[model samples]
Target: MIPLAWYLIFSAALFCIGLFGALARKNAVAILMGVELMLNAVNVNLIAFWHYYAQMRSTPYVHGLAFTTMVFVVAAAEVAVGLALVISAYRRRQTPVVDELTLLKG
Candidate 1:
């Protein structure tokens, strides 16, 4: 069987890459994609931990799965709202650059 450490390492790398993309990207869509990547990394960790714990112990591992599901729901909602806002901003400013959104008086 695959080691648990490998899963965690991969997830950590994905999370870091996502974080960098989110922080360093200038485009709103790229930023949203980065956020999605980070959320996927979180799901990976959750599932990995659940698998490890469920096998080592006799207790149920539903909590982790449930939490992961919740994260998916929240991520979906966030993406929907975020994209809507981004679209609105793009319509108003004609640009997707994050730095150009200084005037939120609309």
Candidate 2:
């Protein structure tokens, strides 16, 4: 049987990789992918905790799965909105590189 610590370690590694990608990447789409990776890592942790802790009690937590599902839905919405913003920015500037988007002089 796989250990819970291994799962947690993998999730943490994935989150860290995503964070690094988001911070280091210049392209807007690459950053978006990194954000999605981070979200997926969080989702994996949530589901793992739900599966291991929430289901162990005699009276299981019925709402754990529901909460995780809601989180996934919210993540999906966030990705959609973020990608739409990136697309709009690309259309306006013809460049999807984050470092080149310094034209917002207000």
**Best by TM-score, which number?**
1
Model 1, stretches more than 4 Å misplaced? none
Per-residue C-alpha lDDT of model 2 across residues 1-106, encoded as one tens digit per residue: 5777888999999999999999999998899888888988887888788778855777778565787788789878988998998888888899999888765756
In candidate 2, list every pair of residues with a backbone clash.
none
The true-versus-predicted C-alpha distance at residue 80 of model 1, in Å, is: 0.3
Report lDDT (CA) for all predictions: 0.94, 0.84
Number of clashing pairs, model 1? 0
Each model's Cα RMSD: 1.4, 1.5
- Using Cα atoms with residue i matched to residue i, what is each candidate's TM-score against the true structure? 0.94, 0.88
Instruction: In angstroms, give how far residue 1 of model 2 lies from its true place.
Output: 2.6
